[model samples]
Target: MRQSYQDWKGQSIEAKRSQLRGETKDLPVPVHIQKEPPFWDVFPENPEVFKLVVQARALGVLRLEENRNTEEKVIRYTRETVIGSENVEIASSWEEAVQVLEVLACRPDKEAIGRQVSAKLADADQAQDKLGLYDQFINYLKQREAELEKIGGSDSPDYKREATIIKDLITSENLQLDNKSKLSVIQLVISPEKPLVDFIEEPHISNISPVEPPFMAGANVFCTECGEQNPARSKFCYNCGTRLVKPN
Candidate 1:
């Protein structure tokens, strides 16, 4: 399997690009690692493998895998990394990938473990744009909200609330956004066209209310509990220890 992967790896990103353009239908795997399923799982359900792919891209090399046969479950991951080569099968399920990545993590430095974690944490550019994606999602919510307002929808208490939050986030930029909420929003946005009624239900992650960790500083993210102003990078309120919004 490793040898097969090695053979498929192109000499350069351009080479991979050419291959992607030609046959494999090469998809862009961004630096932002996805936590939820499908859009996250569409690439690799395993966080470990997903994280590794993110690191590889940062290092100027990224593996572009081709699953030619879905039935056979063959995942040919041709690494596109600064280094010469590396490959690992993420397995059929996330649980399986965890086992796979765990084994790889224990191997010598030559193994893919160290190389994966050593890369830079994804920024706004390299990683998937959760905010930008949410922007589209907010638009969807707004449309839904407008429709609901017409009917006096009972399910979604105030669709405008999410819109207000999203609007505030757009202007202020320092607001503490929840990561799980971001995932939930993204999931709902691209989801398989659910009923308007189903859509009205509050997002799953919104209930969890996990605080979003900020990508950058300079903005002030407030605490959910005490409403204390905290830095964008602050995970908890200095005074309240409450989860800060936007990002920690």
Candidate 2:
């Protein structure tokens, strides 16, 4: 047989060198491979053996050896058709893929802090409804300039043109106000012995009408013993003390 297949391949290469010296006899001492040089004395711009072969192919420890002249069933059918088999073997080295993309870009998220606290509570409720409509238009222009200084003759030019039209309707930055100056101050305070013109001409016709007697301008009255509306110059019931009565 060819010298008995050359002594069975020299006893299968001394039984794989005594089973690789008994599996490297408790490990440590193996480092000697060095001398490879001569590809014109090596260093072809040495990037440290291409960064240690890209850190041993990213730590999966760069394996590949089995070719026993190829065909151990075509190298175990090309290592069982090799395709990424569930990936995750990491370490290939751009600084550990930039430290795993900086730990997934450091967290933050609650929908961007709830859209910045809903845009600062809608800019503090539009600055508190524009400071409550500028204090109800400056207390209706200081009660129409104290009822045009109590009816005009404050050295009249119709009291300096209705106090410069109630100081340009309360310092106008245009918050509006002229419904013909509140209907010419409600037709200069109506009169048929004004209990606001008998509560606007008998509001619910005559509940014994006529007791709100004092200088009546725009009366209001109500109190059938305490419903309390009061204000035709109010002699009481400033919200329930009760006793005011004069329109009869």
Candidate 3:
């Protein structure tokens, strides 16, 4: 039997609460809507929806329309479907959505979700709220750092990407992040030594000649006055300083 909207919402709330209580794994969206076209039609008009669409397309679960070529077109179509609006003026919103989409598209892992949450937390205006979120952010960094270390360490693309996000967060002047949080974030990304993979054997150049031959044809100029055999490239004789005749 199909449950009414209220019943579904109630179940959603229960699931959320269970997730928070560690009784169930937290999912960003309802299980029914995750892979269903009917729910996709009514998906929320947000970055998460865009991420889902991109992920679906990447995984061959979704296909672009016949004429949709550019990213702006994709962005427009996403808005038109998710928000039920076709009048959106694509400007800074497109840029912001694109940034979020790129991050989410590159990573199909929970780390991408964590980055989104971190960005939102960094945007908090109230100092108290920021202070409260700082511990969570630190925990995220620690977990991400450990994961990266296990897989590919500091040289991993994932590590570099997360480090870039951390660097941006710390350097953003508008963010109200505390000094301690900033320092702690910095400590996670930087390292004193380069990765071993970066070291390469230098090629042997010790026996290579530094000087070139007189010419490609081994030609030389015999000075008329001094009989000095100067290189064909020389304009003047090396011994007598006399102008060499053209060798035709």
| lDDT values for all models | 0.42, 0.36, 0.43
Residue lDDT tens for model 2, 1-248:
43343344334333433454454323223222553212212112233333332222222233223434322211010111155432121122323321221222211211222233334324433333333444553554454456567564455454454345434433543333233333334445544332332222333543323344353455677666767566666665544345678586
Q: Candidates 1 and 2: which is better by lDDT? A: 1
Note the residue pairs that clash in candidate 3.
none
**Two-way lDDT contest, 1 vs 3, winner:** 3
TM-score, predicted candidate 1 vs. hidden true structure: 0.23
Residue-level lDDT of model 3, residues 45-65, one tens digit each, is 454444443332222233233
RMSD of 2: 34.3
Mind sharing the TM-score for model 3?
A: 0.25
Poorest 10 consecutive residues by lDDT, candidate 3: 193-202
Q: Return the TM-score for each candidate structure.
A: 0.23, 0.16, 0.25
